[model samples]
Structure formats: structure tokens, C-alpha cells
Target: MATSNGGLRNMTEGSPARHIVLFALPLLAGSFLQQLYNMVDSWVVGQYVGDAALAAVGIGFPVIFMFTSLFMGLANGGTVVIAQFYGAGELDRVRDAVDTIYTAFTFSAVPVTLLAVGLVKPILFLLRVDDAAYDDAWLYLTVVCAGLIGTIGYNLNAGILGGLGNSSTTLRFLAVAALLNIALDLILVLVCGWGVFGVAIATVVSQAFSWLYGLWYINRRYPQIAIRPFCRRFDRSLFGQIMGIGLPAGIQMSLVALGAMVVMSKINTFGKEFTAGYNVGYRLDQLAFLPVQSLSNAVTAFVGQNIGARRLDRARQGIRVTVVSSVVWSLLMAALLIPFGPNLVGLFSDTPAVIDAGAVYLRCIMPFYAIFAVMFSLNNAMRGAGESMFPMLDAIFSLILLRVPAVYFLANRFGSDYMYYGIGIGWMLGFTLSALYYLSGRWKRHGSLADRDRRA
Candidate 1:
């Protein structure tokens, strides 16, 4: 809480090894809760709606990710920009950056939310959901997309805190959101018999609380960063700069989402039993992925803040420390998940066939957890240092250009289970390329956003 000669600041300007972890700890907890926020819905639906409905919800997952990806890119770009402003000792600009992020969230969420609402039926049709899944998938996606307003606020505020190096604040919101979601999930599905609609309703309501809490915290604690809605007009040059950074990130995420949608389509071909299996596997894996991914996020914030201060060497060292730590963490997770896959996946299904299917998906995919740790840690570090292009391109190449096509070609030989291999191989290629880009020291040669701060 106190600042000494060296302390944990919202904007860390120096790379102190211990300090970075300290800053990251709260975020790790929060990210876990955010993952829970998602999982609670599936858990509730699984317990109540049966496997077919659960598979329907699972089929909607990539579309949800795709819709949210734009908001995430905006948040990511704004966070890095604001972190650099803080490092440059540009308080006014830092405040303006936050305002820009808030505005961006509003405008961006409007069209996306409407599009999601409008296309709900057609999109479900496109995903190839069968007769059994039609009603449930339609209900779930409509409700979730309706809550984009809430999701927007949470994403924007979290990005602000992350940029400022207080991932704790962001996590705090997630905790509240997750708790709210859990309560509603039980009430709606178990008590009210709402089933699939219950899960979506619970998530949206929980997101509302998360968003409100974020808005309150930022306005109360960091008044300097709060924007007066509609009063501030957009600046074209700044807007362009924000998009220039975020667009590639968005495209990258879209490519990944597109690839996932394709994979899900393949699973759909195997019928609801296999699709249910993939859904359960995908949701449960989020539990393991969050730890490493959250740490990667911390790495980005730490690296971004320090890089802005011209502490390039320290930034690189932070990546080294984070990558090594994530590997150990991920391996432990895989060990636990692989052995207990049946128990974990079974929670989502009562039918023995669905349970067995889900367990197989988890066991096969859990082995590749370490590669994800490596991928996220290294990729986020690159993005934080403003070297996002390579990671973005690599995702496109691996996820779409390679994995999706492979899933279709190998679907027959490898059987329905081939979907797992397609995703794993894609990750391996992405991780290798990302690590290579970082080690090549190409990030250093590209000239950084940090350089602009020095001149200013």
C-alpha cells in the first residue's frame, strides 16, 4: 500500500522480480473467477438440461468468443497505450487514454450486441445445430448477447486497471461477477426450471454486477480516468492509432474463432454425443488455461509499464521468468486433469455415453496444456512490448490455414476424436513461431512504442 524507493505502483516503472509476481497474484485469482463465471453456466445447464442442450450451448461458444474479441482487442490496445502514458509521466494523456477506452467500449458494443441479437437464429443454423439443439441454442445465445453492455464495461475497466498495473482491481470485479453468476445459476436452473435459458440469464445478470462494480471503482478511486459520456467527441488521429493497434489483434482472434467454429462444426457431424464431449472438455480446460493465461496478462502489463520506462532488459527478463513459471504451473495442472478427467467431465453429464465421450476429450487435450502456457506467456509478452504482428499472423496461419483444414481431411482416419489433435497441432505451431519471433530478437529491431514516449 505504501510506496518506498521501490514499490508496487499501479504503473510499475521498474522491473523488480518479486514485485511483478506480487502485482500478478490478485489477477490470477480474478482470472480464475472469470473462468468460473463462464463455467458456472455450463455446470448448471449440464446438471439440468441434459447433454443435447449442453452441446447446443457448446456450439455457441466460438460465436460468443468472436463477438467479444473486438471488445478485447480495443481493451488490449488501450491498456498498452495508457500504460505507456503512465510510464512517460504523462498523466493527462493517461487519463485521456482511459476516456478513449470507455468511449470505444460503448460504440463497439452497440453494433456487436445488435448483430448478435439479430443473427441468433441464422448463426445457430450455420453452426449446423440439429433439431434437438435448435430451441436451446437460440435461447442461450440471445440472452448472452443481450448482456454485451455489461461485458463491455467489465472489459474496459479491467483493461484500464491492467494498463495501470493493478490487476487486483480488475479481479475484484470478476469475483463479484462470478459469485453473482453462481447464485443465479442455481436459482434459475434448479429452482425455476429455466434450463438453458437459465444459464444465459444467470451469466448476463452476473455480468451486470461486474460491470457496475467496475464503473463504480474507477469513478470513485481514479476520477481522473472517468469520461463524461457523450460530452467528449472522438479524435480521428487517436481513433486511428487505437484501431491500428487493435485491428490486427481482432483479426487474429477472429481467425482463431473461425477455426474453432469449424472444429465445432466437425464435432456436430459426429452428432450431439461427441459435440457434448467437446463442450465439456472445452469448458473444463478453461480452469487450467486461466492460470497461465492470467500470468501472461500480468507479464504484458509488467513488460508494457517497464518498457515505457526504457527498461528493455528488465522486460525481457520478466518474460523469461514468466515463461518458466507457467510451464511448471501448467504441468501440475495437466497431471491433475489427466488422471481425474472422468470425474471432472462427468459433472456435466448424467448419461454414461456422454460422460465417456467427455472424459476422452479431456484426457487427450490435457496433455498439451504446457504448450498453451508457453504460447500465451510468450505471445502476450510480445504484444505487451508492442510486437503483436508476429503472434497475430501465427495464429491465423496455425489455427485457420493449418488446423481447420486438417480437421476436415483427417476427420475420417482419426475418427471424431481428431478435433483434439487439430487444435493441439495448431497450438504447437503457433507456440513455436511465437517463441522463435521472440528469440530472434526481432521485437527489438522493430522499434517500439516506448521509443515514441522517449521522444515526447
Candidate 2:
């Protein structure tokens, strides 16, 4: 009953660990390459442009993320819906869901771009982005927003392929984009003297290329779900279904990004050195946890497919395997990052203060990565099972209600060194909630697309 053709790999019939691991490897590689290009941007700006530019890029991240989180969440929901339909052998529904996702993102991208571009200055002012970095931040964010269509398109394409259990193809797409981005960064920033604007242009151009390439590849290789940009097929019922699941997840993502902005505002008070250092440390942290994130994504798709196949036991088994693997990976990363954290931070800047500040952040948060992994794994499993609302509530409670306030209180009371402790505290709270909910097995009742079909 397992099908493997035209880049699709059925997960419902394999050894859960094998399926999860094989699927996750490519995702892990793709994430690494994606992060690599991002780090390259930071490196170019920090080394060639200056710490102010570095800080500017950092300032723009959470703001852009906040604006785009809704679409990302909706794309995630589309992935789940498509995965479930694919697992249940409903090819027609899968195609319909894919088309609907494409249609929705295409229509909405322009409006979101305009809104985000208009708000960039106000949001930067609110975040208290330092005067030195404000102009670069505004320009960089504006250009990126102007090309939001490319970013959204790339992500939706990845989401659709992921839903079909074809993470490998996306890996290839990312590789092309990553190389192009790195080349463009060097050429635009160093050769052309474009500075921060060049960096932003590089990102936009590379992502646009990747999106177009993915569209062409998908149409050529997987005609079953060919995307028709001009036809504009919009499925009202499917769009509603995607919204039902994605809206809460989108709200959660937005709140989380907002919380990050709040935390960034606090960090910005310390000066650009600290902001740049935090940005470098955060980039390193993202790299360290890439495997865990990939495994969590694998679990989501795995659980979605198995649940759709009505194989609850397989879904449970896959979750256990992924959690264990993520914990072990986190432990390894912590051991490595804790000792050499400063040295790695030095790669971006030669400043002793920046390196020291970055080291402090890593030391504070690295040890608690296992807790973060557990929280994400369990919560994502619930999302995979169509139980997205509770995960949204959990993120709101732990990340927004608890973490944001804790960061502010800790920074004000103990100092900046202790600010990252708030992140660990949030992780603990999230893990506790996720564990309790996962154990109750109520997620199984959340109902997959297949279950709805059976009932009808």
C-alpha cells in the first residue's frame, strides 16, 4: 500500500524510525544550507558593512516574521491537510488542497507586502531600533517586504511537497537558492558596494528564483498536482478547512513573533553590540537545533499520514522515536556549543565584547535545548493530528504570557546575562503542558480528513 514514485514516499507502511530518519535527513541538510545563507548575510554585513548593519538585519527579522507568520501557519495547515488526504489515497483532494494553498497565497501576497512595507518604520521606531541602525533596518525590511511574494511562494511550494512526503525535492531547491544567495550576497555587498540594500536584494532575487524553479519542477515532475498560476482555481470548502486549522496556528506564530520583538526591544536598550551579539548567538542557536526542528517536522508529517491511514499505533511510535532522537541530538549540540560558543561567535565579529555577549546567551540557553525539543515535538504532533488549537493556546501561554514577561523581569532585575533564562523557563512550561496533553491521547479524537470522509 506504500507508494514511492515521482518523488513521493508513503510513510504509513514503513518502519517508523526508518521513515522518520530518512525523511528528516534531507530536511536537516536543507535547513542547514538555508541557515548557512542567512549566516552568510550576517557575516557579510558584520565584517564588511559594520555592527550597525548587523544589528539592523537582526532588528528586521522578528518584524518581518511577525507579518509573514500567518501565511506560514496557513501553509503548515495545508501541508497537514494534503498529507492526510494523500495518506488516505485521496489524490483528488490532495491536488485540490495544493491548488487552494497556491491560490490563497498568490492573491494575498501583495496586500500583505504593502501593509508590512508601510508599517516597517513605525514598528522599527516602536522597537527602539538604535539611530545608527534604523535607516538600514528600514530599507532592508522594506525591500524584503516588497518581494514578499517570492518568500511566500517558496514556503508554500515547500509545504506542498512536504505534504506529499517529498522533502528531498525541496532540499534540492534550497541548495540552489542557498548557493545563489551566497553568491549574490558576495557580489552585491562586496563587489557592488550596495551594503545592506545589496544584502536584501540578494535575498529577494534568490528566493524568487527558487520559487519559480520549484513551480516549474513541480509542474514537470508531478503533474498530479500541477500549479496553474493563471487558472486561479479556488476551492471555497478546502480554503475554509485550511483556515480552520491554520488560523489558530497563525495567531500563535504571530504572538510568538510579537513576543520576540518585545524581547528584542529590551535587548536594544543595551546597545548595538549586544543586539549584534544576540543576533549571532540566536543564529548559532538556530543552527544547533536544526536537527531537532527537522525531526519535529518529520514527526508532524509522519503523524499526519499515519493518522489518516487510521494507524494510531504507528503515529504514536513515530513520535516516540523522533522525541528520543531529538533529545539525544540536543544533548550533543549542547555539549559542543557550551565550550566553544565564544569561538564560534568570533566568526562573525572580532570584537571581544560582541563575542563575550554572544557566549553568555549560548551558555544560558544551550543546556535547556532538550526541553525545547520535547515541547516542539509533542506540540507539533498535536498539530499533525489536526489538534492545532490547543497547541496555539499552549504557545500563547508559555511563549507570550510567560516568556515575554519573564524576559522583561529578569533583564530588569538580574541584568542582561540572566535575560535568556526566561527562554528556558518558557521551554519548561511548554514541555510540561505538551507532555500532559500527549499522554492523555485525546489528540486522536481531533479527526483527520479521512475520518470526516468516513463519517459523511
Candidate 3:
């Protein structure tokens, strides 16, 4: 059983359903709050700075998510390995996995950081960012990218903590950082009149602080999970194991983000008002999925630890709870978004055309949120069991393989409304395919938590 600070119940030591919920609550809350924290940047900027500024932030997100996605993919894979190793009582292997994730991702992070900062202008131009908003987008992306490593570090460390069932600590740390972000956003962006640059700097500053805090927590309370400096002391076999898992996971996110970038390019062709409206709709959708996102992450660790412990039934139970709970929240949110669509979109833009376009997009896509919930949870569950290829496949089929083509052809045929519908349909396709794959009883027999322990 995994133990942190010398003695702690492994996260899945009880009834699977109850334990899953207990473990997930803190993470769920943190996820919601963190999403809220993100919303603060847009809300503050949109309300105070103006539509162009808000649009710039929106344009910057895909680029930022693309950079973070690389590290995040590695971290997702690392977290799965850490959980399995921790649950299996392989402390040394757990340490090794954590170290590999820290080292490899950090090395990759530095170059990506430089690239994001240096190439922000050309990158945005390639995405068709217009002259009016290019300056703000470049400014936002540059400052955020400057501290990208700090963001990556904090996420990587937090992944380690989550694997160890110490997610409550991550929740608190993120809460503190999010609060600081809110305060700084108000002071710098709203009160001080620094604009988008201020919001960007504040985000990076808080991320740096969180990175330090996470590192401090690991060193003080969980030294075993501490990542050693890279040297020949690093084990090649274990490094390979972590990378084997993480690379596909990272590719999964990259594909999804890449697809979004493609769609954003299409949205760009519609002119600034439409692109701006799409941004509003997308941000609101992100906000709405906060609970499911947090729960999906929790599901990964929960399923991983349980599977590591040889509790197959329990893993399935946790996944069931994930599906049902996520669907419930999704239904509630979709209802809210569909009805109050204008109010939500108008939060960003006062113009009627932009508001109408955003409202239509939200109404078009809201119902599929439940299917998205399923896809998110099941993909995480699969990854937790050390099967990452499905997620990559899921992202590929939905986004690149199918989604891109669907949007392109459908947009040409039935207008962009069909393009919006295409995203939802493709998501459903992936979700349905993944569900059938899981039910086929393959991932279950592939391995178990007990099997991992025996290997150790």
C-alpha cells in the first residue's frame, strides 16, 4: 500500500465506490476552483480591458495548452506509473518514475518555453490572428511562456502527490495560488490598468510560487518522491517505462489541442467577430466541464491504485461512479448553458453578432457534454491501467482522423453550425468506441494492481 509521511491508508483501502468518492471530492473541488481561477483572467480582462484583449487571451490559450500539453502528457503517464508503483509497494521504482518525469519533461520544457516566447508572433500569424488583436495575443503568450517551466514543474509535482493519494495537499496549494491569482488580477489588471500583460505576469508568478510550494511539500513530507538531479545515476530501464507511458499520453493531448487549433483556424476565416464569439463559447464550455475534468483526473489515480492493488471490480466501480456523476453534472450544465447562452456569451462581448454567434455555438454543443464526460473518465481509466494507446486513438479518431474532416466537409455543406455539430458527433464516436472497447473485457485482463505488486 502507498504510504506518504511514513503512514497513510492507501487511497483504495475500502469499498471502491465510497473510497473513490472520498478521494475525488477534494480533487473535484480543486478542479472547479482552478477552472474558476482561470475564468478570473478572462472575466477580469473582458470586463475591464475590452473585447480585443479578451480575444487575445483566447487566442493565446491553444498555444499555451499546446506547450503545456507536451509536459502534461508526460505527467499523465508519470502519474499512472507512480500510482502503480506506489500501490505495489515499489518505493524505489516510484521514485525513479517520478525522477524520470521530472527530468525528461523539464529538459523538453526549456526548449518549448523558448519556442513559445520567441515564436508567439509567427505562430499566431500562422493561425490567422489579425492585426487588431495580434499585439495583445503576442504579449499574453510571451509572458505566460516565459514562466512555462514553473507551470510544468508544479503540475509534475502535483501529479506525484496525487498518485500518492495526497491530493488534498494539492487542493490546498492550488487554492492558495488561485486566490493569489485573483487578487493579483484585480490589482494589476483592473486597478492598476496594466491590461493583458498584467494578467499574464500574475499567472506565471503564482505558478512559480506553486512550483516552489509543491517541491517544498515533497521534500519535507514525502522525500521518497523527490526527484534526484539528472546524472548517470538515473536508471535507463525505469526512464523508458515512464516515457513509454507518457509519450502516447502527451500525443493524445497534442492531437486534441491540434484539432482545436485547426478548428480555430476555420473560425478565424469567419472574421474577428465570429472568432471572438467562438472564444467566448469555448471558454464557457471549459468552465462548465471543471467538475468532470477534476473527476476524470481523480478517476485515473483511483483506477490506477485500485488496479495496482488487484481490485478489478473496484476499479470498475469507481469508473461507474465517474460516469454517472459526470453525466449528472453535465446535464445540469448543458441546461444552464443552453438557456442562458446569450448572458454567458455577452459576458465577453457586448456586440450583438458576436453574442448571437457564441450563443448558437453553445446551444449546439451543450448537450454532448455528457458524452464528453464519459470520454474523459474512460480515457483516464484506461491510462490508469497502463493502457495509453486508446486515449491517443480516441483523440486521433475524434480530432484529426475524423473530426477535422467532418468539420471541413460539413462546414462547406451546411454552414459552420454543422461544424459545431461535427465536434459533438465526433466526441460521441470516440466515447462510444472507447466504451465498447472497455466492455470487451480487454483492459481488465491486461493487468491488475495485485499483478503489479507481485512483479515488484
Candidate 4:
């Protein structure tokens, strides 16, 4: 088991805090840069293409998300499985898991791509996209959905790398793609007058490049786990192991996506200004949320690896450290955004109404960031420990049972301002559920003989 370059990090050793922090820094940067792609799209469109265009692109987001949610869930599942096996020093199982996910995604992406492209019109209609921006939304969704394979490809490789405790590789690829996306967005949209079409093209091309780079790097560097073509005797057992964890993760994400679409439908009925403002605020929300998200992702890998190494105590310690770190980070971000949220909102659009509405949403939502941070940190640790069901159920109960109804009720009864309050309520409920689950320690006994067999 030799390390190839610095792409392979073994997190089953040394101080948990130090390793998790180092691993997460790259991930944080990568996620920020990844979010930057969207922020840039919003900025360019708002400034050049008009606010209607900005709102249109924003409307298309949930549609694309619903399609990709399954793949992302599977990728997260595959990552945990790989991280555990890597931790256990089971190179053969690692390779099999990698290939199995690759094979699965390869077969799934084609249909999803076609289905997404075909369903764009009805999906947009269902979201109740307004006539003012319908054309722009349709164009963006069509192009982006058509490129689903690129998204699938990059995430598949990135998940495998993360599972192997190699956030640096993912960062490097994303960094390159991020820079390329920015330049492309500027030139194609601002200079070439490509509008939403240009923005979607820039994203598709950038994602494809990232995917190609990841594929090449994995093959050239870690040939042991490089995904080779499927054989007649494909490992069905390993496939089951990956999907067993991945499917629940995927279903949870899709359910969340569905909730988002439902919420978006409610938002759209408020008309274009609210839609534009919400999307702008949501972009900033993701940016502010990146630190916790990155830490949670790092914890998944950290826990998986340690669990694989038969170091359950170390995995638990990593989660504790990450939760503390994520809370501090969340608080700092919330404080910075709360008072000056209007100024940040202004960067996307010069419309005073847009800025005011977006700022209001941000100010209302920022204070509650820590609650979601705690929920994510604990829940991701569980997923890393191969306990995806509890986290999925928490999401189901919180978002579907609580948040969606609250959002619709508030938006229709009180106003859009009241709708933001639902975020805090949802976070509290989810955090409580995840914390209770973690305290129960059911994740500890969930270990499998297959994991030990891999090590054997």
C-alpha cells in the first residue's frame, strides 16, 4: 500500500482534528469555487442579461437538482464504502467498489440525460415558471439537463477520491474548472451575448473537463482503484454493498430535492421579484454554508476510514471535533452576513427591490446557520459509519413533514418574509433528530462482517 503522489491521504492515523482540518480546507475551497460558478452566473446575468434572466436560471436549478440527486446520493454512498475499505487496507475491495459505481452511473446517466431533456417543458410548467422568464428557464434547463453525464462523471470520480481520503485531488480538479467557468461565463455571456445559454454551456464544459481530469489522474496515479471496464463476472456482491448504502443516501437527497421543488413552486407563485431575490439569497446561503458542508464531507471520509481500521473511538472523536469547528465557522459567517447582507445582495443585481428582498431573507436566515451545521456534522458522520437510514429519515421528517408545509402556509398566509422562518424551524428539528440518533450510538453496532472480511 504505497501512496501515489500526495493524492492519497490515510486519515486513520495521527490527530483527528489536524487531519480533518487539513482534509476539509481543500474541500472548503473547492466547494466555494464550485458555488462561485453559480454566483458568477447570477452576477453576469443580472448585470448584463437582466433580472428576469437571473430569475429564469434560478428557476431551472431545482429541475436540474432533481435529476442529479440520485447520482449524488449513490456517489456519497460509494465514497463511504470506499473510505472504509481504504481504511481497512483492502485495496482489492476498493477497486471493486470504484468500478461498480462507475458501471452503475454509466448505465444510469444516459436515461437520466434523455429523460431530463425531454421533461424540461413539463417540469418548468409544474414549477409555475412565469411567462416573463419562461423562455430563459426552458433554454437553461434544456442545455444543462442535456449535459447530465458530465455531472455524473465528475462526481463519480470525485466521490471515489474523497472516500480514499484525497480531498486535494478533488480540489485541484475543481479549482481548474472553477477558473475556467468564470472566464467562460464572462466571455460567453457578457461579450458574446450568449445569455442563459452561454452560462449553461460554460458549466457543462467546465464539468466535463473536471471529469476527464479526474478519470485520467485516477488511472495514471492510483491504477489499483482506477475504474476499468465491466467484465462478465462483475462483482455483484460489491455492487450491493455500495448501492445498499448509496440508495438511501440518494433517496434522501431526491426527497430533499423534491421538497425544494415544492418550495420553489410556492416561491414562483409570488412572481419574479421574489424568485430573483430568493435565488440570489440561496446562492449566498450556499457560499456561507460551505465550511460546514466541507467539514461534514471530510468527517464522512474520516469516520469511514477509522471505522474501517477498527478505530470506532477515533471516528467518534473526529465527529465531535468537526461539530465544534463547524459551529464556530457557522457563527462567524452568520455574524459577518447578518448586518451587511444588503451589500452582499447588491452585488448580484442593482435593483433596489431585489436587494431589499434578498437582504431580508439573509438577515432572517443567517442566525440559524449553526443549527443546520450541527445537523449536517452529526448526520454525515452517521453516513460515514454506514448508517444512512436515520439521516434520510430525519431529512424526510424535517423537510417534507415540517418545512414544506410551513413554507407554503407562511408564503400564502403571512408573506415571503415569514417563509424564511421555516428554515430555522426545519434546522432545529433535523438537528434534534440527528443528535438523538448519534447519542443513541446505533451507528456503532451497524458494522458489517463484509467490512471485516475485506480486511481479512
Model 2, 90-137: lDDT tens digits are: 998998888788778878888998998899888988899888998999
* Candidate 3 ranges beyond 4 A from true positions: 1-9, 227-233, 448-456
All candidates' TM-scores?
0.93, 0.98, 0.93, 0.96
Model 4 lDDT per residue over 1-456, tens place:
223445688887889998898889899999999998889999999989998899998887777887888899888988998888888887877877877887787667888899899999988888888889999999999998988887888888889889888888888889978999999999999889999999999989998888888788778877677666353235687777777788888888888888888888888887888889889998998999898999999999999988888899899899999999999999999989888888999888888888888987888788889988999899999999889888899999987789998887777788887888887788889989989888998988867424555454
Per-candidate clashes come to: 1, 0, 6, 0
The reply for model 1, stretches above 4 Å from the true place, is 1-15, 446-456
Point out the worst 10-residue segment of candidate 4 by lDDT: 226-235
Prediction 4 TM-score vs. true: 0.96
Off by over 4 Å in 2: 1-3, 454-456
Ranking by TM-score: 2, 4, 1, 3
Instruction: Please give the lDDT score at residue 340 for candidate 1.
Output: 88
Q: What is the lDDT of every predicted structure here?
A: 0.75, 0.90, 0.78, 0.86
lDDT of 2 at 21: 88
Evaluation by TM-score, superior candidate among 2 and 4: 2
Stretch of 10 with least lDDT, candidate 1:
1-10
Error of 2 at 11 (Å): 0.6
